[model samples]
Target: MSTATQVPELSVRVRDRLARRHPGALIGELTVLPGGHSGLTYSVTAGDHRYVVKAVPPGQRPVGRNDVLRQARVLGALAGAVEQVPVPGVVAVDETQPAWFAMDFAVGEAVEPVLDEPEVPAATARARMLEIASVLRRLHATDTRTPGLDAPEPLDAAGELERWSRTLHAVPPELRPGGEELLARLAADVPGGMPPVLLHGDFRLGNVLCDGERAVAVVDWEIWSVGDPRIDLGWFLLFADHRNFPQLGHAVPGLPSEAELLDAYLGDRPALPAMDWFRALGRMKMAAIMGHNLRRHREGKHHDPDQERLPPTIAAMIRTARDILG
Candidate 1:
């Protein structure tokens, strides 16, 4: 969370920019929102309406995922077009330095795989997971060549491996045991034939805003891109096993087994080949991510003690990837 003094000008600029969109509306305070990796997120009020503000951090160039307007393009393209799966509506945008965009604050809670809400019934939680699976299937079915996606070529399986490998290389080897071997295995047997689709990059129960058993909005487009659908599928499937996400713990009722979730996703579609490779790649990606974060934590650059528990999990993911490959 940003302190009042941190980005004091942010609120003023946001209010000024938003005012153009909703003339005569009285804009309220802008409150910093926590948890996004791309940039500073905030919730602001204007008249009777509330909106979310995703912006490039102060002084940083708005390139890659930090380009909030790029994300806004995605939101604009997908909003209200895909059935069942809804993303936030783009309300306004400012492409200036510290580029930002305001979107309708998606209404609902972001539920974890465990369905941590005590009031949500087990049946309801299970239903939500299946619904999310269906939503993912539909999302992938959408044309990858959608105008705003902007990528000339899709990121294939090997390219995906290389992308994460760059992150893995930054971490000390001990943190990610067998990570290189796992990457090599994934690369040697790159899957082919699956058509390119719009990938959420980190699609899962936790990323969606839900109302009861329904996923109202799929939030967090920070890492979204055009790629093989399995990249997202495998990532989402990793959550089915509690071990991959130890922070959520095990034995929380109501989530579907990974097989059931995949079945739901496939529905009438044929089974995707080389899924084992994709699954292994998913584990490797997670290991790399955790390992990098663990290194950061150890180096005192990012202070999060919870990352300490990640070494075993990272090792486990690499082992699992190797085992799956073998």
Candidate 2:
């Protein structure tokens, strides 16, 4: 059956599970939401409320990004935080039979493909980016023992490198020329002593919901972990470097520069270790991610035409990482 015809059937499946969690409520249509890179998402309504539901596709192992419960745990913890971190509020969850959770549907505009939005004035975009940096700083300050995070063992700089290495080693050698050399350099001089905090994993304008000039909420917690804050800061800063994404655009008109972002994130707080290694590690991680996705695209496991254009970008990331490491 065509995808259009199948959505309703799939919606019914999710609705049934949601009904089990929120018994007696009259649930509405579970319309499939677009643009989730991992896990299944839907816009659902029950009684007078609306929600966004995330679930692992049926019969698929609920591991990695597909683990909706894990994402929910973070959201649930942040929801009750003494210092509010802008995030969705969890409403209900069902762990049995195709694990799924519902969060209050965030109401705001999505500023994804951040660089591609020319209509949004550069000042507005830059302001929004600065706002996001402040929010990230708040999240980093949140207690890691916030109940649902499981008293996490934070990943140090070395652990961060090893985590992405697994993905790097899985790809074709040709796709990542200086991959091993980069990994070795990163491993040799692992920066230490930064206390781990709640990391957004993927922190960028695209992952947030914005209302006017403000970043109202940060969404998508699939890879959230306890790690050196720079891991998130470095990754977030990389987006401002147009060289990393040649396919996106040449000039970032209004987006905050990397230095500006770092300054905003650091504020008056004492500086941690130099971010060069972390920056290099971020690029390496990006290259590995693009390489893995490119491999999957070619193998027809995940067919996205965009992945076809990533080879040059991947090469550029590795090259840039080397330059940063120097």
TM-score of each: 0.91, 0.89
* Candidates' RMSD to native: 2.4, 3.0
lDDT of 1 by residue, 276-296 (tens): 888898988888888998999
Best by TM-score: 1
Pairs in clash, predicted candidate 1: none
Off by over 4 Å in 2: 1-26, 113-119
Estimate, for each residue in 1-326, the C-alpha lDDT of model 2 and write its tens digit. 11223555566666786677678999877777877788888788776778898888877999989989999999999988876789988877878767888888888866643455634666777788888888988899888888998745787788888889999989899999898999998888888748779988999988888887888889989989997888998888888857677675466476778888888888898765869898898999999998999999999998999888888888888989999999
How much is the lDDT of residue 76 in candidate 1? 83
Model 2 is weakest, by summed lDDT over 10 consecutive residues, at 1-10
Instruction: Predict model 2's lDDT versus the native.
Output: 0.83
